[model samples]
Target: MSDHTIRAEAPGDEAAIYNLIAQAFAPMPFADGDEQELVNRLRADGDLALSLVAVDAGGVIVGHVGFSPATIDHAACGWFQMAPVSVCPPRQLQGIGSALIEAGLRHLREQGASGVAVVGNPAYYERFGFTVIDGLAPASEHDQPYFRAQAFDRSAPAGTLRYAPAFG
Candidate 1:
């Protein structure tokens, strides 16, 4: 069994987190190298809701997950958007991703977030209670099961899920 713990990311973890994210997501689709840009923008914009990491027993960062601010028009609803979730290549499928996601969602709930959105696999995210928002358009054309949402508290917003400009 892998010895791992999930916790909020720290300032000291910047380098490790960057390296882990680059290595883990180097093969995926979507904007490449934009992960770091998104992270930087979120931090600079003061919109990061939660930045979490999973570390092994030896203190190696193996996974990272981030929840940033998402909004829809005039409503001041707190929307959590999950992206750039990365798990070390060797650590993939060992539950690190799931753990990070769960921990991040829990943290968002405790922080009083109204809802959370994700642009990811529905099959995988469904385990965390995510569901398709009927009648809700995605922020982009890419929105589908991959761009889904789940209400950590009450129901999710019924309109489009507008991600931050950094996502553009």
Candidate 2:
């Protein structure tokens, strides 16, 4: 992880970030071919709570992560949703995604987020303290096994974990 640096996303990273996300999830069966569009809508709608990127020694963007404000009952709680976490095609399993998640979570905490939710692999996200919460998930994947949450407040909220309108 020392070889890669994680930082907040800056201007001029849109294209690279889009490409990286598209490339990373290109092989996934669950992908709706809308990951990049989701990120774009989040950004355009000012719902992107945190956008982070991992750059290698040469300053090449190898990974990216986006956390957007989520609603429990339609914007009633201070929660965030880890939208899309992506690593370059050749850079998978190299800790780049982990670094991005760690840094992104830290930033969310600093921003006073109460909890975070994600629709991701349980095995990989559990290391970050994400666990499935009963009845806590996106509208479409309600109560699915892959839905997970980690509360910085130590008390995860109840209700549906509604992502930004972009996720729809």
Candidate 3:
């Protein structure tokens, strides 16, 4: 049986979430080592539209995924950015990260978000229906190649996609 359950972040989950994120990204070559801080910034700036955590049977947070509002063409298009998906090293590769992401996306959809964007491996995000739209792009040229998006009930717009300020 699975040892963890996915759910919304609670008031005291910040410290656990931060530690887990730092541990999860520490070994990744692409990680900038500020992902944990980014999450804190998002929460402080009130840009974290949604945050979910995976809790083990013992009540420890083992995974986390954050969703923040984003803009397309510099307009409020109900788009969000999914980022820093993390699973503790000891608990990695057990689908914990994927489950957190799916739960986050599902919540966003129910909340009427028009779409979600992510900058990551195509092979991974593609499974969640994220794809590169011909005319849709990220504001940062460095992110252009890795950026992908998935539209929900509404059609995605073409133009620069800006992530929340905490992403800077």
Worst window of 10 by summed lDDT in candidate 3:
150-159
Question: How do all the candidates rank in terms of TM-score, highest first?
Answer: 3, 2, 1
Quote each prediction's TM-score: 0.90, 0.93, 0.97
**Candidate 3: global Cα-lDDT?**
0.91
lDDT for each candidate structure: 0.80, 0.86, 0.91
- Residue 4 accuracy (lDDT) in model 2: 90
- By lDDT, the best candidate is 3
lDDT of 2 at 2: 79
lDDT of 2 by residue, 1-168 (tens): 579999888999989999989998899998878898888999999988799999999999999999988888776588888979999888899899998999988888887789888887889999998986665666665536788898888674777778888887
Model 3 stretches astray by more than 4 angstroms: none
Q: Candidate 3, residues 1-168: lDDT per residue as tens digits?
A: 288999889999999999999999999999999999999999999998899999999999999999999998889889999988999999988988888888888888898889999999999999988998878899988998899998897564788999999998
Instruction: Residues 1-111, candidate 1: write the lDDT tens digits.
Output: 459988888888877887887887787776477786677677678876689989899988889998888876635588878887899899998889988888888888888
Colliding residue pairs in candidate 3: none
Q: Residue 167 CA error for candidate 2 (Å)?
A: 0.6
Ranking by lDDT: 3, 2, 1
Q: Where does model 2 exceed 4 Å of error? A: none
What C-alpha lDDT, on a 0 to 100 scale, does residue 10 get in candidate 3? 93
